[model samples]
Target: MRLTGLPLILLAGALTIATVVATVRWWRRLPIRIAGLLVMEVLLVLEAGLIANRMARFYPSWQALGGTPEVAVVAATTAGRLDASIAAGEAIPWTPPGSGSWGLATTPLVVVPPDYLTCPDRRFPVVIVLTGVTPRPAEGVLSVVLAPTARTNAASLATVPAALSADFRVTDTYAVVAGPGPAQPGLHALRSFDEAVRELPPPLTAPHRLPS
Candidate 1:
Protein backbone atom coordinates (compact mmCIF):
# COMPACT_ATOMS: atom_id res chain seq x y z
CA MET A 1 0.00 0.00 0.00
CA ARG A 2 1.08 3.61 -0.56
CA LEU A 3 2.51 5.45 2.42
CA THR A 4 0.22 8.42 1.80
CA GLY A 5 -3.22 8.31 0.17
CA LEU A 6 -6.94 8.04 0.87
CA PRO A 7 -7.00 4.25 0.58
CA LEU A 8 -4.35 3.72 3.24
CA ILE A 9 -6.01 6.33 5.45
CA LEU A 10 -9.37 4.54 5.18
CA LEU A 11 -7.79 1.18 5.93
CA ALA A 12 -6.06 2.55 9.01
CA GLY A 13 -9.32 4.14 10.21
CA ALA A 14 -11.16 0.85 9.72
CA LEU A 15 -8.53 -1.07 11.67
CA THR A 16 -8.67 1.47 14.47
CA ILE A 17 -12.45 1.18 14.63
CA ALA A 18 -12.28 -2.65 14.65
CA THR A 19 -9.72 -2.57 17.49
CA VAL A 20 -11.87 -0.16 19.49
CA VAL A 21 -14.99 -2.32 19.09
CA ALA A 22 -13.10 -5.50 19.97
CA THR A 23 -11.61 -3.91 23.12
CA VAL A 24 -15.06 -2.77 24.32
CA ARG A 25 -16.69 -6.16 23.57
CA TRP A 26 -14.02 -8.05 25.54
CA TRP A 27 -14.03 -5.76 28.57
CA ARG A 28 -15.29 -8.51 30.94
CA ARG A 29 -12.52 -10.90 29.90
CA LEU A 30 -9.29 -9.72 31.61
CA PRO A 31 -6.66 -11.24 29.30
CA ILE A 32 -8.73 -10.67 26.14
CA ARG A 33 -9.53 -7.10 27.23
CA ILE A 34 -5.88 -6.34 27.96
CA ALA A 35 -4.77 -7.72 24.59
CA GLY A 36 -7.53 -5.81 22.78
CA LEU A 37 -6.62 -2.58 24.60
CA LEU A 38 -2.92 -2.98 23.73
CA VAL A 39 -3.76 -3.66 20.12
CA MET A 40 -6.12 -0.71 20.07
CA GLU A 41 -3.47 1.63 21.47
CA VAL A 42 -0.95 0.56 18.87
CA LEU A 43 -3.50 0.86 16.09
CA LEU A 44 -4.54 4.31 17.28
CA VAL A 45 -0.94 5.51 17.31
CA LEU A 46 -0.29 4.09 13.84
CA GLU A 47 -3.44 5.73 12.53
CA ALA A 48 -2.43 9.09 14.01
CA GLY A 49 1.07 8.86 12.59
CA LEU A 50 -0.29 7.91 9.17
CA ILE A 51 -2.64 10.90 9.21
CA ALA A 52 0.20 13.26 10.14
CA ASN A 53 2.43 11.80 7.48
CA ARG A 54 -0.26 12.39 4.89
CA MET A 55 -0.62 16.02 5.95
CA ALA A 56 3.08 16.83 6.30
CA ARG A 57 4.35 14.59 3.43
CA PHE A 58 7.28 13.52 5.58
CA TYR A 59 7.33 10.16 3.83
CA PRO A 60 5.83 10.01 0.35
CA SER A 61 6.09 6.23 0.02
CA TRP A 62 6.85 3.12 2.08
CA GLN A 63 10.19 2.83 0.28
CA ALA A 64 11.13 6.33 1.40
CA LEU A 65 10.27 5.53 5.00
CA GLY A 66 12.30 2.33 4.73
CA GLY A 67 15.29 4.38 3.46
CA THR A 68 15.36 2.71 0.05
CA PRO A 69 17.27 4.73 -2.54
CA GLU A 70 15.32 6.25 -5.39
CA VAL A 71 15.97 5.29 -9.02
CA ALA A 72 19.19 6.90 -10.24
CA VAL A 73 21.26 7.10 -13.41
CA VAL A 74 23.68 4.24 -13.84
CA ALA A 75 26.83 5.90 -15.20
CA ALA A 76 28.74 4.04 -17.89
CA THR A 77 31.86 5.32 -19.70
CA THR A 78 31.87 2.87 -22.59
CA ALA A 79 30.50 5.49 -24.97
CA GLY A 80 33.41 7.16 -26.76
CA ARG A 81 31.57 10.23 -28.07
CA LEU A 82 28.66 12.50 -27.18
CA ASP A 83 26.75 11.16 -30.18
CA ALA A 84 27.05 7.62 -28.89
CA SER A 85 25.82 8.60 -25.43
CA ILE A 86 23.05 10.83 -26.79
CA ALA A 87 21.87 8.20 -29.24
CA ALA A 88 21.54 5.64 -26.47
CA GLY A 89 20.31 8.22 -23.95
CA GLU A 90 22.77 6.86 -21.43
CA ALA A 91 23.87 8.41 -18.15
CA ILE A 92 27.56 9.17 -17.71
CA PRO A 93 29.52 10.09 -14.59
CA TRP A 94 30.92 13.61 -14.73
CA THR A 95 33.22 15.34 -12.23
CA PRO A 96 32.03 18.87 -13.16
CA PRO A 97 35.48 20.10 -14.23
CA GLY A 98 36.42 21.53 -10.84
CA SER A 99 33.95 19.93 -8.44
CA GLY A 100 36.48 19.85 -5.64
CA SER A 101 36.05 23.61 -5.18
CA TRP A 102 32.30 23.02 -4.88
CA GLY A 103 32.87 20.52 -2.01
CA LEU A 104 31.07 17.73 -3.84
CA ALA A 105 31.81 14.16 -2.82
CA THR A 106 30.25 12.02 -5.55
CA THR A 107 30.50 12.90 -9.23
CA PRO A 108 27.30 14.22 -10.82
CA LEU A 109 25.53 12.20 -13.51
CA VAL A 110 24.66 13.61 -16.96
CA VAL A 111 22.02 12.30 -19.34
CA VAL A 112 21.90 13.99 -22.72
CA PRO A 113 18.73 14.07 -24.78
CA PRO A 114 18.25 11.41 -27.45
CA ASP A 115 17.80 14.15 -30.05
CA TYR A 116 20.97 15.92 -29.01
CA LEU A 117 22.90 14.71 -32.03
CA THR A 118 20.08 15.58 -34.48
CA CYS A 119 20.40 19.31 -33.85
CA PRO A 120 24.06 20.14 -34.05
CA ASP A 121 23.72 23.92 -33.65
CA ARG A 122 20.79 23.85 -31.24
CA ARG A 123 21.81 24.19 -27.61
CA PHE A 124 19.51 22.55 -25.11
CA PRO A 125 18.33 24.00 -21.82
CA VAL A 126 19.57 22.38 -18.65
CA VAL A 127 17.49 21.05 -15.75
CA ILE A 128 19.46 20.70 -12.54
CA VAL A 129 17.98 17.93 -10.42
CA LEU A 130 18.72 18.12 -6.69
CA THR A 131 17.76 15.20 -4.49
CA GLY A 132 17.33 15.10 -0.68
CA VAL A 133 19.74 12.16 -0.46
CA THR A 134 22.54 11.03 -2.71
CA PRO A 135 21.42 8.60 -5.41
CA ARG A 136 23.39 5.52 -6.36
CA PRO A 137 24.22 4.33 -9.87
CA ALA A 138 21.25 1.99 -10.16
CA GLU A 139 18.76 3.57 -12.63
CA GLY A 140 17.42 6.53 -14.80
CA VAL A 141 18.65 8.65 -17.78
CA LEU A 142 18.86 12.29 -19.29
CA SER A 143 19.31 15.70 -17.60
CA VAL A 144 22.06 17.02 -15.33
CA VAL A 145 21.66 15.43 -11.91
CA LEU A 146 23.49 17.00 -8.96
CA ALA A 147 23.78 15.56 -5.48
CA PRO A 148 24.60 18.57 -3.32
CA THR A 149 25.07 18.79 0.44
CA ALA A 150 23.20 21.09 2.86
CA ARG A 151 26.04 23.57 2.44
CA THR A 152 25.57 23.58 -1.35
CA ASN A 153 24.77 27.07 -2.57
CA ALA A 154 24.67 28.85 -5.98
CA ALA A 155 28.20 30.13 -5.48
CA SER A 156 29.56 26.64 -4.88
CA LEU A 157 27.60 25.41 -7.89
CA ALA A 158 28.78 28.23 -10.18
CA THR A 159 31.20 25.95 -11.97
CA VAL A 160 28.40 23.65 -13.12
CA PRO A 161 27.51 25.74 -16.17
CA ALA A 162 31.09 26.10 -17.22
CA ALA A 163 31.71 22.40 -16.78
CA LEU A 164 28.59 21.41 -18.69
CA SER A 165 29.35 23.91 -21.44
CA ALA A 166 32.80 22.43 -21.86
CA ASP A 167 31.47 18.87 -22.00
CA PHE A 168 28.14 19.39 -23.77
CA ARG A 169 26.29 21.90 -25.93
CA VAL A 170 24.05 23.77 -23.52
CA THR A 171 22.49 27.22 -23.56
CA ASP A 172 22.85 29.83 -20.84
CA THR A 173 19.19 29.34 -19.84
CA TYR A 174 18.42 26.64 -17.27
CA ALA A 175 15.92 25.71 -14.56
CA VAL A 176 16.52 24.72 -10.98
CA VAL A 177 14.10 22.68 -8.89
CA ALA A 178 14.35 20.24 -6.02
CA GLY A 179 13.91 16.83 -7.61
CA PRO A 180 12.63 15.75 -4.33
CA GLY A 181 16.03 19.93 -0.53
CA PRO A 182 16.56 23.57 0.19
CA ALA A 183 16.65 24.43 -3.54
CA GLN A 184 16.21 28.17 -2.99
CA PRO A 185 19.54 28.99 -4.57
CA GLY A 186 18.64 26.82 -7.55
CA LEU A 187 15.52 28.89 -8.11
CA HIS A 188 17.60 32.04 -7.77
CA ALA A 189 19.99 30.69 -10.35
CA LEU A 190 17.10 30.21 -12.74
CA ARG A 191 16.23 33.88 -12.41
CA SER A 192 19.84 34.82 -12.95
CA PHE A 193 19.89 32.84 -16.20
CA ASP A 194 16.60 34.48 -17.32
CA GLU A 195 15.23 31.38 -19.08
CA ALA A 196 12.83 28.55 -18.39
CA VAL A 197 13.71 24.90 -17.77
CA ARG A 198 11.90 21.99 -19.33
CA GLU A 199 11.66 18.17 -19.33
CA LEU A 200 11.40 17.74 -15.55
CA PRO A 201 10.52 14.24 -14.32
CA PRO A 202 7.58 13.29 -12.11
CA PRO A 203 7.09 15.26 -8.80
CA LEU A 204 8.91 18.18 -10.47
CA THR A 205 7.15 20.91 -12.46
CA ALA A 206 8.15 22.16 -15.95
CA PRO A 207 6.67 24.36 -18.68
CA HIS A 208 8.17 22.75 -21.78
CA ARG A 209 8.05 19.26 -23.24
CA LEU A 210 10.20 16.50 -21.75
CA PRO A 211 13.34 15.41 -23.60
CA SER A 212 12.92 12.80 -26.33
Candidate 2:
Protein backbone atom coordinates (compact mmCIF):
# COMPACT_ATOMS: atom_id res chain seq x y z
CA MET A 1 0.00 0.00 0.00
CA ARG A 2 1.17 3.52 -0.81
CA LEU A 3 1.72 5.48 2.40
CA THR A 4 0.97 9.09 1.60
CA GLY A 5 1.42 12.09 3.88
CA LEU A 6 -2.24 13.13 3.88
CA PRO A 7 -3.41 9.75 5.03
CA LEU A 8 -0.70 9.67 7.65
CA ILE A 9 -1.64 13.11 8.85
CA LEU A 10 -5.28 12.11 9.09
CA LEU A 11 -4.43 8.93 10.94
CA ALA A 12 -2.21 10.80 13.38
CA GLY A 13 -4.87 13.36 14.06
CA ALA A 14 -7.50 10.68 14.66
CA LEU A 15 -5.22 8.76 16.99
CA THR A 16 -4.40 11.92 18.93
CA ILE A 17 -8.07 12.73 19.35
CA ALA A 18 -8.87 9.17 20.38
CA THR A 19 -6.06 9.14 22.93
CA VAL A 20 -7.20 12.42 24.43
CA VAL A 21 -10.83 11.28 24.65
CA ALA A 22 -9.82 7.96 26.21
CA THR A 23 -7.53 9.60 28.75
CA VAL A 24 -10.19 12.10 29.75
CA ARG A 25 -12.80 9.37 30.14
CA TRP A 26 -10.48 7.21 32.25
CA TRP A 27 -8.76 9.95 34.24
CA ARG A 28 -9.63 8.16 37.51
CA ARG A 29 -8.20 4.87 36.16
CA LEU A 30 -4.52 5.82 36.03
CA PRO A 31 -2.94 2.52 34.94
CA ILE A 32 -5.35 1.77 32.08
CA ARG A 33 -5.33 5.36 30.78
CA ILE A 34 -1.53 5.55 30.78
CA ALA A 35 -1.18 2.25 28.95
CA GLY A 36 -3.73 3.26 26.34
CA LEU A 37 -2.02 6.60 25.81
CA LEU A 38 1.36 4.87 25.47
CA VAL A 39 0.03 2.54 22.81
CA MET A 40 -1.34 5.47 20.84
CA GLU A 41 1.94 7.27 21.10
CA VAL A 42 3.81 4.27 19.76
CA LEU A 43 1.51 4.06 16.78
CA LEU A 44 1.96 7.75 16.07
CA VAL A 45 5.70 7.48 16.34
CA LEU A 46 5.86 4.52 13.98
CA GLU A 47 3.66 6.34 11.49
CA ALA A 48 5.77 9.45 11.66
CA GLY A 49 8.99 7.51 11.08
CA LEU A 50 7.54 5.72 8.08
CA ILE A 51 6.32 8.98 6.59
CA ALA A 52 9.68 10.58 7.15
CA ASN A 53 11.50 7.77 5.41
CA ARG A 54 9.19 7.92 2.39
CA MET A 55 8.61 11.69 2.41
CA ALA A 56 10.50 12.39 -0.78
CA ARG A 57 8.81 9.72 -2.93
CA PHE A 58 5.34 9.12 -1.54
CA TYR A 59 2.39 11.52 -1.62
CA PRO A 60 3.41 13.17 -4.84
CA SER A 61 2.26 16.71 -5.47
CA TRP A 62 -0.59 17.62 -7.81
CA GLN A 63 1.83 18.57 -10.55
CA ALA A 64 3.58 15.26 -10.33
CA LEU A 65 0.28 13.41 -10.54
CA GLY A 66 -0.61 15.23 -13.72
CA GLY A 67 0.38 13.62 -17.02
CA THR A 68 2.88 15.31 -19.30
CA PRO A 69 2.95 15.15 -23.11
CA GLU A 70 6.06 12.96 -23.23
CA VAL A 71 4.51 10.46 -20.84
CA ALA A 72 1.31 10.45 -22.91
CA VAL A 73 3.25 9.59 -26.06
CA VAL A 74 5.09 6.78 -24.40
CA ALA A 75 1.89 5.29 -23.03
CA ALA A 76 0.18 5.57 -26.39
CA THR A 77 3.07 3.98 -28.21
CA THR A 78 3.29 0.89 -26.02
CA ALA A 79 -0.23 0.74 -24.59
CA GLY A 80 -1.56 -2.47 -26.12
CA ARG A 81 1.60 -3.61 -27.90
CA LEU A 82 2.13 -6.18 -25.17
CA ASP A 83 -0.55 -8.80 -25.95
CA ALA A 84 -3.59 -8.56 -28.18
CA SER A 85 -5.78 -10.55 -30.62
CA ILE A 86 -2.85 -11.57 -32.79
CA ALA A 87 -0.71 -14.40 -31.48
CA ALA A 88 -0.06 -17.01 -28.78
CA GLY A 89 2.66 -17.84 -26.25
CA GLU A 90 3.78 -17.07 -22.72
CA ALA A 91 4.09 -13.31 -22.55
CA ILE A 92 7.33 -11.79 -21.34
CA PRO A 93 7.60 -8.40 -19.63
CA TRP A 94 8.89 -5.94 -22.18
CA THR A 95 8.63 -2.38 -23.47
CA PRO A 96 9.53 -1.34 -27.00
CA PRO A 97 11.25 1.79 -25.76
CA GLY A 98 11.77 2.92 -22.19
CA SER A 99 10.01 2.58 -18.87
CA GLY A 100 7.81 5.62 -19.44
CA SER A 101 4.85 3.57 -20.69
CA TRP A 102 2.33 3.24 -17.84
CA GLY A 103 5.35 3.27 -15.50
CA LEU A 104 4.58 -0.47 -15.21
CA ALA A 105 5.97 -3.64 -16.71
CA THR A 106 4.26 -4.10 -20.08
CA THR A 107 4.19 -7.30 -22.18
CA PRO A 108 4.12 -8.14 -25.87
CA LEU A 109 2.08 -11.33 -26.62
CA VAL A 110 2.75 -12.27 -30.22
CA VAL A 111 1.48 -15.19 -32.31
CA VAL A 112 0.93 -15.33 -36.03
CA PRO A 113 -0.94 -17.76 -38.26
CA PRO A 114 0.46 -21.32 -38.31
CA ASP A 115 1.63 -20.82 -41.88
CA TYR A 116 2.99 -17.29 -41.41
CA LEU A 117 6.65 -18.29 -41.39
CA THR A 118 6.30 -20.29 -44.59
CA CYS A 119 3.62 -18.19 -46.27
CA PRO A 120 4.54 -16.28 -49.38
CA ASP A 121 4.26 -12.76 -47.92
CA ARG A 122 4.37 -13.48 -44.16
CA ARG A 123 1.89 -10.62 -44.03
CA PHE A 124 -0.91 -11.99 -41.84
CA PRO A 125 -4.11 -10.25 -40.88
CA VAL A 126 -3.04 -9.00 -37.46
CA VAL A 127 -5.98 -8.47 -35.08
CA ILE A 128 -5.24 -6.53 -31.92
CA VAL A 129 -7.88 -7.62 -29.38
CA LEU A 130 -8.56 -6.19 -25.97
CA THR A 131 -10.42 -8.75 -23.92
CA GLY A 132 -12.32 -8.40 -20.69
CA VAL A 133 -10.00 -7.98 -17.71
CA THR A 134 -9.36 -11.72 -17.38
CA PRO A 135 -5.55 -11.37 -17.32
CA ARG A 136 -5.11 -14.21 -19.79
CA PRO A 137 -3.55 -14.52 -23.20
CA ALA A 138 -5.73 -12.79 -25.83
CA GLU A 139 -4.58 -15.19 -28.52
CA GLY A 140 -5.72 -18.13 -26.45
CA VAL A 141 -9.10 -16.57 -25.95
CA LEU A 142 -9.52 -16.00 -29.69
CA SER A 143 -8.48 -19.51 -30.52
CA VAL A 144 -10.96 -21.03 -28.12
CA VAL A 145 -13.70 -18.46 -28.54
CA LEU A 146 -13.50 -17.90 -32.27
CA ALA A 147 -11.46 -20.70 -33.74
CA PRO A 148 -14.44 -22.92 -34.49
CA THR A 149 -16.31 -20.13 -36.23
CA ALA A 150 -13.20 -18.95 -38.02
CA ARG A 151 -12.61 -22.40 -39.39
CA THR A 152 -16.15 -22.58 -40.67
CA ASN A 153 -15.62 -19.34 -42.61
CA ALA A 154 -12.08 -20.22 -43.67
CA ALA A 155 -10.92 -17.16 -41.71
CA SER A 156 -7.37 -16.67 -40.50
CA LEU A 157 -6.93 -14.15 -37.70
CA ALA A 158 -3.84 -13.37 -35.66
CA THR A 159 -3.92 -12.13 -32.07
CA VAL A 160 -1.75 -9.86 -29.96
CA PRO A 161 -2.86 -10.11 -26.34
CA ALA A 162 -1.52 -7.19 -24.36
CA ALA A 163 -2.60 -5.49 -21.18
CA LEU A 164 -1.54 -2.40 -19.22
CA SER A 165 -0.95 -3.99 -15.81
CA ALA A 166 -1.02 -7.79 -15.76
CA ASP A 167 2.29 -9.08 -14.43
CA PHE A 168 1.24 -10.47 -11.07
CA ARG A 169 4.54 -12.33 -10.73
CA VAL A 170 6.35 -9.05 -11.27
CA THR A 171 4.80 -6.73 -8.69
CA ASP A 172 1.69 -6.76 -6.55
CA THR A 173 1.33 -3.00 -6.70
CA TYR A 174 0.94 -2.94 -10.47
CA ALA A 175 -2.27 -1.13 -11.42
CA VAL A 176 -3.90 0.77 -14.29
CA VAL A 177 -7.37 2.27 -14.68
CA ALA A 178 -8.47 3.92 -17.89
CA GLY A 179 -10.48 7.00 -17.10
CA PRO A 180 -10.60 10.78 -17.41
CA GLY A 181 -9.37 11.02 -13.83
CA PRO A 182 -5.80 11.93 -13.07
CA ALA A 183 -4.85 8.47 -11.81
CA GLN A 184 -5.67 6.95 -15.20
CA PRO A 185 -3.42 8.83 -17.57
CA GLY A 186 -4.35 6.77 -20.58
CA LEU A 187 -7.82 8.15 -21.17
CA HIS A 188 -8.11 7.13 -24.80
CA ALA A 189 -6.28 3.83 -24.45
CA LEU A 190 -8.81 2.02 -26.65
CA ARG A 191 -7.33 3.98 -29.52
CA SER A 192 -4.47 1.54 -29.41
CA PHE A 193 -6.83 -1.22 -30.47
CA ASP A 194 -7.91 0.94 -33.37
CA GLU A 195 -4.36 1.94 -34.23
CA ALA A 196 -3.27 -1.69 -34.24
CA VAL A 197 -5.02 -2.24 -37.57
CA ARG A 198 -2.09 -0.53 -39.27
CA GLU A 199 0.64 -1.95 -37.04
CA LEU A 200 2.72 -4.73 -38.63
CA PRO A 201 4.88 -7.13 -36.65
CA PRO A 202 7.93 -5.67 -34.86
CA PRO A 203 10.50 -6.07 -37.67
CA LEU A 204 8.17 -4.59 -40.31
CA THR A 205 11.12 -5.68 -42.49
CA ALA A 206 12.54 -8.58 -44.47
CA PRO A 207 13.41 -11.12 -41.78
CA HIS A 208 9.74 -11.83 -40.95
CA ARG A 209 8.88 -11.97 -44.66
CA LEU A 210 8.61 -15.24 -46.55
CA PRO A 211 10.86 -16.36 -49.43
CA SER A 212 9.54 -15.77 -52.91
Candidate 3:
Protein backbone atom coordinates (compact mmCIF):
# COMPACT_ATOMS: atom_id res chain seq x y z
CA MET A 1 0.00 0.00 0.00
CA ARG A 2 1.12 3.54 -0.78
CA LEU A 3 2.14 5.40 2.35
CA THR A 4 0.93 8.99 2.41
CA GLY A 5 1.39 11.83 4.90
CA LEU A 6 -2.10 11.48 6.38
CA PRO A 7 -1.83 7.73 6.83
CA LEU A 8 1.62 8.05 8.32
CA ILE A 9 0.36 10.67 10.73
CA LEU A 10 -2.50 8.37 11.75
CA LEU A 11 -0.13 5.46 12.18
CA ALA A 12 2.20 7.51 14.35
CA GLY A 13 -0.73 8.67 16.52
CA ALA A 14 -2.01 5.12 16.87
CA LEU A 15 1.42 3.93 17.89
CA THR A 16 1.62 6.68 20.53
CA ILE A 17 -1.78 5.64 21.93
CA ALA A 18 -0.69 2.00 21.98
CA THR A 19 2.48 2.91 23.83
CA VAL A 20 0.48 4.85 26.45
CA VAL A 21 -2.01 2.01 26.89
CA ALA A 22 0.80 -0.54 27.34
CA THR A 23 2.56 1.68 29.92
CA VAL A 24 -0.71 2.19 31.83
CA ARG A 25 -1.51 -1.58 31.84
CA TRP A 26 2.01 -2.71 32.83
CA TRP A 27 3.54 0.22 34.70
CA ARG A 28 7.08 -1.15 35.08
CA ARG A 29 7.17 -4.07 32.64
CA LEU A 30 8.92 -4.19 29.22
CA PRO A 31 10.88 -1.05 29.95
CA ILE A 32 13.20 -1.70 27.01
CA ARG A 33 10.35 -1.98 24.47
CA ILE A 34 8.61 1.11 25.80
CA ALA A 35 11.77 3.19 25.83
CA GLY A 36 12.62 2.08 22.29
CA LEU A 37 9.17 3.01 21.01
CA LEU A 38 9.32 6.44 22.65
CA VAL A 39 12.74 7.09 21.16
CA MET A 40 11.46 6.03 17.71
CA GLU A 41 8.48 8.33 17.95
CA VAL A 42 10.62 11.33 18.90
CA LEU A 43 12.98 10.60 16.04
CA LEU A 44 10.06 10.30 13.60
CA VAL A 45 8.70 13.68 14.61
CA LEU A 46 12.11 15.32 14.25
CA GLU A 47 12.62 13.74 10.84
CA ALA A 48 9.25 14.97 9.63
CA GLY A 49 9.99 18.52 10.77
CA LEU A 50 13.35 18.52 9.01
CA ILE A 51 11.78 17.21 5.83
CA ALA A 52 9.11 19.89 5.91
CA ASN A 53 11.69 22.66 6.30
CA ARG A 54 13.73 21.33 3.39
CA MET A 55 10.66 21.10 1.16
CA ALA A 56 9.72 24.72 1.91
CA ARG A 57 13.17 25.93 0.85
CA PHE A 58 13.69 23.56 -2.06
CA TYR A 59 10.40 24.32 -3.83
CA PRO A 60 11.33 27.94 -4.63
CA SER A 61 14.86 27.11 -5.78
CA TRP A 62 13.60 24.24 -7.94
CA GLN A 63 10.89 26.40 -9.46
CA ALA A 64 13.38 29.12 -10.42
CA LEU A 65 15.53 26.57 -12.21
CA GLY A 66 12.69 24.75 -13.93
CA GLY A 67 10.03 25.98 -16.42
CA THR A 68 9.55 27.22 -20.01
CA PRO A 69 12.64 28.69 -21.74
CA GLU A 70 11.34 31.58 -23.80
CA VAL A 71 12.25 35.22 -24.34
CA ALA A 72 9.97 38.24 -23.75
CA VAL A 73 10.31 41.30 -25.90
CA VAL A 74 8.89 44.73 -25.09
CA ALA A 75 9.31 46.92 -28.10
CA ALA A 76 9.47 50.70 -27.95
CA THR A 77 9.19 52.76 -31.12
CA THR A 78 11.78 55.28 -29.98
CA ALA A 79 14.77 54.79 -27.70
CA GLY A 80 14.08 58.14 -26.02
CA ARG A 81 10.57 57.10 -24.96
CA LEU A 82 11.95 53.79 -23.67
CA ASP A 83 14.62 55.65 -21.76
CA ALA A 84 12.25 58.24 -20.34
CA SER A 85 9.53 55.84 -19.26
CA ILE A 86 11.03 52.38 -18.60
CA ALA A 87 14.55 53.50 -17.87
CA ALA A 88 13.55 56.01 -15.21
CA GLY A 89 14.90 54.62 -11.93
CA GLU A 90 17.98 53.04 -10.28
CA ALA A 91 17.25 49.80 -12.16
CA ILE A 92 19.04 48.69 -15.37
CA PRO A 93 18.01 47.18 -18.69
CA TRP A 94 19.71 44.62 -21.01
CA THR A 95 19.09 43.69 -24.62
CA PRO A 96 20.34 41.15 -27.21
CA PRO A 97 19.49 42.71 -30.58
CA GLY A 98 21.40 41.25 -33.60
CA SER A 99 23.31 38.94 -31.27
CA GLY A 100 21.58 35.96 -32.91
CA SER A 101 22.53 36.87 -36.47
CA TRP A 102 24.91 34.28 -37.99
CA GLY A 103 27.79 36.37 -39.25
CA LEU A 104 31.25 37.23 -38.08
CA ALA A 105 30.63 40.90 -38.76
CA THR A 106 27.36 40.77 -36.86
CA THR A 107 27.68 42.20 -33.37
CA PRO A 108 25.04 42.94 -30.77
CA LEU A 109 23.90 46.57 -30.86
CA VAL A 110 23.80 48.32 -27.46
CA VAL A 111 22.04 51.63 -26.89
CA VAL A 112 22.44 53.78 -23.80
CA PRO A 113 20.07 56.65 -23.25
CA PRO A 114 21.60 60.10 -23.46
CA ASP A 115 21.69 62.13 -20.26
CA TYR A 116 19.71 64.84 -22.04
CA LEU A 117 17.05 62.25 -22.94
CA THR A 118 15.69 62.50 -19.42
CA CYS A 119 16.00 64.77 -16.37
CA PRO A 120 19.59 64.86 -15.15
CA ASP A 121 18.39 64.39 -11.58
CA ARG A 122 16.40 61.28 -12.45
CA ARG A 123 18.28 58.00 -12.55
CA PHE A 124 17.59 56.19 -15.81
CA PRO A 125 17.43 52.43 -15.92
CA VAL A 126 20.70 51.19 -17.36
CA VAL A 127 20.45 48.41 -19.94
CA ILE A 128 23.52 46.21 -19.74
CA VAL A 129 24.26 43.79 -22.55
CA LEU A 130 26.00 40.66 -21.33
CA THR A 131 28.06 39.52 -24.29
CA GLY A 132 28.47 35.87 -25.18
CA VAL A 133 31.67 33.77 -24.78
CA THR A 134 34.69 35.79 -25.80
CA PRO A 135 38.44 35.27 -25.54
CA ARG A 136 38.72 38.74 -24.10
CA PRO A 137 38.10 38.97 -20.35
CA ALA A 138 36.39 42.34 -20.68
CA GLU A 139 32.77 42.59 -19.53
CA GLY A 140 30.08 42.40 -22.28
CA VAL A 141 32.39 40.72 -24.78
CA LEU A 142 30.92 37.36 -25.83
CA SER A 143 32.06 34.70 -28.25
CA VAL A 144 30.74 35.30 -31.76
CA VAL A 145 28.71 32.10 -32.01
CA LEU A 146 27.62 32.07 -28.39
CA ALA A 147 26.49 35.70 -28.41
CA PRO A 148 23.69 35.18 -30.91
CA THR A 149 22.48 32.02 -29.24
CA ALA A 150 22.38 33.72 -25.85
CA ARG A 151 20.40 36.65 -27.21
CA THR A 152 17.86 34.38 -28.88
CA ASN A 153 17.46 32.29 -25.79
CA ALA A 154 16.97 35.39 -23.67
CA ALA A 155 14.00 36.33 -25.85
CA SER A 156 12.57 32.82 -25.54
CA LEU A 157 12.93 32.51 -21.79
CA ALA A 158 11.49 35.91 -20.82
CA THR A 159 8.51 34.16 -19.31
CA VAL A 160 10.63 32.70 -16.49
CA PRO A 161 11.16 36.01 -14.70
CA ALA A 162 7.51 36.85 -15.26
CA ALA A 163 6.42 33.62 -13.60
CA LEU A 164 9.01 33.86 -10.85
CA SER A 165 7.90 37.38 -9.92
CA ALA A 166 4.68 35.94 -8.44
CA ASP A 167 6.62 34.11 -5.72
CA PHE A 168 9.72 36.31 -5.46
CA ARG A 169 10.46 40.04 -5.69
CA VAL A 170 10.98 40.03 -9.44
CA THR A 171 10.87 43.43 -11.14
CA ASP A 172 7.87 43.24 -13.46
CA THR A 173 8.66 46.50 -15.28
CA TYR A 174 12.12 45.41 -16.38
CA ALA A 175 12.87 44.41 -19.97
CA VAL A 176 15.05 41.65 -21.45
CA VAL A 177 16.05 41.04 -25.08
CA ALA A 178 17.39 37.60 -25.92
CA GLY A 179 19.20 36.72 -29.12
CA PRO A 180 20.10 33.27 -30.52
CA GLY A 181 22.89 30.85 -29.69
CA PRO A 182 23.92 27.15 -29.96
CA ALA A 183 21.32 26.32 -27.33
CA GLN A 184 19.63 29.36 -25.82
CA PRO A 185 21.80 32.27 -24.75
CA GLY A 186 19.01 33.62 -22.58
CA LEU A 187 19.46 30.73 -20.13
CA HIS A 188 22.87 32.05 -19.14
CA ALA A 189 21.48 35.58 -18.88
CA LEU A 190 18.68 34.29 -16.67
CA ARG A 191 21.19 32.45 -14.51
CA SER A 192 23.34 35.53 -14.26
CA PHE A 193 20.33 37.70 -13.37
CA ASP A 194 19.22 35.21 -10.73
CA GLU A 195 22.65 35.30 -9.15
CA ALA A 196 22.74 39.09 -9.20
CA VAL A 197 19.30 39.47 -7.61
CA ARG A 198 20.09 36.87 -4.95
CA GLU A 199 23.44 38.43 -4.10
CA LEU A 200 22.14 41.98 -3.74
CA PRO A 201 22.75 43.26 -0.24
CA PRO A 202 19.92 44.48 1.91
CA PRO A 203 19.45 48.23 1.67
CA LEU A 204 21.26 50.17 4.33
CA THR A 205 18.94 52.35 6.40
CA ALA A 206 21.47 54.63 8.12
CA PRO A 207 22.99 57.44 6.10
CA HIS A 208 26.38 56.71 7.73
CA ARG A 209 26.29 53.21 6.23
CA LEU A 210 25.97 54.64 2.71
CA PRO A 211 29.12 54.47 0.62
CA SER A 212 31.01 57.68 -0.05
lDDT of 1 by residue, 1-212 (tens): 78899899899889889888887887898998889888888888888999999999999988788886545443322222354344435566776447777655467877666655555544556767665232222212236777777667888888888777666766556566464334546344332211223232221212333334
User: Which one wins on lDDT?
Assistant: 1
Model 1 lDDT vs. the true structure? 0.62
Give candidate 3 regions above 4 Å deviation.
Answer: 1-4, 30-37, 40-212
- Estimate every model's Cα lDDT from 0 to 1: 0.62, 0.36, 0.37
Model 3 poorest ten-residue lDDT run: 136-145
lDDT (tens digit, per residue) of candidate 3 on 83-122? 3343212222233333233322345332323322333322
- Taking all chains together, the TM-score of candidate 1 against the true structure is 0.44
TM-score of each: 0.44, 0.24, 0.24
Q: Which ten residues in a row have the lowest lDDT in candidate 2?
A: 167-176
Residue range 1-212, candidate 2, lDDT tens digits: 34555676667768877887887788789796788778778877876765664676643544544643342221111112333433334333333332233222224333333432323222233343323122333221111111121122111221112222231111111112122322222212233332443333321212322324
Residue 8, candidate 1: C-alpha displacement in angstroms: 88
Best by TM-score: 1
**RMSD after CA superposition, every candidate:** 18.1, 20.8, 17.7
